[model samples]
Target: MTQDSRQSVYERITATIAAAIEAGAGDFRMPWHTDGTMSAHPVNITTGKPYRGINTIALWAAAQGAGYGSAIWGTYRQWAACGAQVRRGEKAALVVFWKIDEREEDAGDMDDGQSDPRRRVLARGYPVFNAAQVEGYTPPPLPALPASARIAHAERFFAALGVTVREGGTRACYIPARDEIRLPPFAAFRDPIAYYATLAHEATHWTGHPDRCARELKGRFGSESYAAEELVAELGAAYLCADLGLACEPRPDHAAYVASWLTVLRNDARAIFTAAAQAQRAADWMHARQPFAA
Candidate 1:
């Protein structure tokens, strides 16, 4: 893709998310908040792989805007390869690919940096249609786990990570100096899902410690960077909730950060992309701790 096209991809996706966030400001609903009907994570029907980073945010915003309950998505040719056809007038949503350009000059394995050309990561956008937008392809629906099972699974997930989590706190947060998460008692939450949702948010923050994802966590408080970090945690929590089959709800305290997030997005079109990528990394790090993770 040309440099202009790459920039357009970032701008386009960022604008979509910013618009969605603005639209939801009235009720604090984010594009990532799922109502238990639609899957939180967007997956490609043909590849059966979940989209990551900005692609996930773009698809989530598209799905939320279009009321698409099905998380399955695929490119035009991908759908065709699966014997599925997009509806004649259905609109396609945009996703991106970051490919590395590997043109280089041989340096003969020497330590001289001047011998090799630096590779560039290029961005390319592709249009995709959701399962609801296509014909002749019906994905098998997975049954939702019971509430008890869902909570049990979440407990085990956190246990596997083995992060120090102390309950019985009024405010839920991750203390960087201590490298631990503090959360209110489970009973303090309105429901079980809310408890886990808050934990997911804090766990995302926990990953930013120097020993983990190593994000700028030490002195970014009350600044744009802090808001950006909050956005990362929010996105990370939503991703985890979706992957864990839990319905995500907006935390009441997070409403205040929406304005800051919008400011960040407005100032930098790539802010959402950066936050989503960092959020994905944090979520991936947590997932890596799972016993079943490959």
Candidate 2:
């Protein structure tokens, strides 16, 4: 594709996510709640691979809006190939991928005249329908484990990070300077998932320490940068929760941030994109540190 095609796709995907975040700012809900149809990570039906980066945000928003409970998604042809038919009236969700093209002739600085690892990655999208939008398809059954059963996994997962977490505090926060997270006792929370959800939020924040991910952290209080970082932490936690099969309800404490997030989105159409990108970076950082357990 040409430059115009790449720009066209980038603009479309950014606008879709920005609109979703803006709409989510209204109610402080991004549709990752337990009450929603799909509580697990959004995945491709054909590939069974989880969607990552901004695509996760896009698909979750679409699934929440459409009340799609199934994780299965695929292109129209894919549905037919699987012996299923997309409902005639069912609209498909927009999913994107990067199309890379390498140019060996353009390697001007290479002494050996070899093609560098560099390649132009273009943003492109396709329309995919959820299994709920199809007929004659039965997704294999997977049970949603109870919060009690998931507690052990959540504990081991975060414990593997080895981040300093202190309980007994009413307010939950990550002190970047000290590099520690404070939270109320897990028992004080309504359930185990909420406890872990809040911890995941702070854990994401911890990943932003200068010694760690070293993200842009010097934002004025109440400034757009600060709001953007908070957006990243919250969304990162949501992504982490999805990874661990925990419920990702928007905390009531985050309600105060809606107006701030909305202000940032209103001023810059791409703010949500940046937030989603950083959020993915944060989630990936922690994911890399997660230890595999039998």
Candidate 2 residue-wise lDDT, 1-294, digit = tens: 687865565566556655665667667776445432234678777777778766777777787777778777889999999999998899877766655453222011111112145755445568889999999998887875776667787898899899999888689999877889999998899988888999999999898887777777344223577888888898888888887878888687888877777677567544555666677777878878876732
- The global C-alpha lDDT for each of the candidates, from Candidate 1 onward, is 0.81, 0.72
After aligning candidate 1 to the native by TM-score, how far in Å is the CA of 122 from where it should be?
Answer: 0.5
Error of 1 at 111 (Å): 26
lDDT by residue for model 1 (166-253), tens:
9875999899888889999889999898889889999999998878878773243236878988998998998888888788897778
**The best candidate in terms of TM-score:** 1
Q: What's the distance in Å from true for residue 174, model 1?
A: 1.3
Q: Which stretches of model 2 miss by more than 4 angstroms?
A: 1-11, 18-27, 34-39, 102-118, 217-223
**Residue clash pairs of candidate 2:** none
Per-candidate Cα RMSD to the true structure, in Å, reads 5.6, 5.9
